[model samples]
Target: MNSDCVFCSLLRDEGAADWIWRGQGASALLPLEDGRLAPGHTLVIADQHAVGVQDVSPAALTQVILLVQQVSVALRDAFGARGVNVLNASGPDSDQSVDHLHFHVVPRWAADGLDTWPGGRSGHRLGTQWPAELRRAVTARQL
Candidate 1:
């Protein structure tokens, strides 16, 4: 394990986390601190120390997706959330903090009032501007 890597340390049981579930190559748990959002938000992380989606193997990717699905259902059932959003940030520009392949399964309630960031009059719908190649790649994954 990478001694200085926070995520690696977590995977090795060298650090503490509020673990909710663990499986062959992934885990899901609640964050210890509240962020810009509320508490009880969950983070689903790969057990292997991949830094980003690009570094995740196909098997790990599949497992992570499944874990996210499971966690989403559980969080909704346990917390009575109106919905949940699964998110990932890849690089520094995108605000990736831990440098580990992880997905945030944020439980959203009506009272949270978390407004999405506003984009200044971009000429495209929020996610519709994704390049065709990128869109095709995502669609092909059947994820």
Candidate 2:
């Protein structure tokens, strides 16, 4: 675990965390941030410190994803959520705030007023046939 990571400290210091579930690979909890966007805005964090999802091993990533699924269900039921959103930011360009790998499991309702879009959102809307370039790139990259 990285000593500089807040999630690592929370893992080491149980009293500082409010857990939905803690396990070998990951833990789910309410975020420590102030003025949460929505009720039951939970964070599913990796137990081992990894800067981004790409840095995590498949096994550990699987564990985190499973826990995210479990937590999403719980939060949905608990909060009577009409819908759910599971979000992640992987790299600096993606605007990942923390260095540790984590996903936001947000319980949502209609007109909840939570803005999930990143800052400086583009005004351009994707026309149906316009994304053919994206498809071509995916094919060229063999992704």
Deviation in angstroms for 11 in model 1? 1.4
TM-score of each: 0.78, 0.78
Which segments of candidate 1 are over 4 A away from where they belong?
117-143
State in Å the error of residue 22, model 2.
Answer: 1.0
lDDT of 1 by residue, 103-129 (tens): 988888986877555556656465655
Model 2: ten consecutive residues of lowest lDDT? 30-39
Screening candidate 2 with a backbone cut-off below 3 angstroms (N, C-alpha, C), the clashing residue pairs are: none
- Runs of candidate 2 with Cα error greater than 4 angstroms are 33-35, 118-143
Candidate 2 structure lDDT: 0.85
Which candidate leads in lDDT? 2
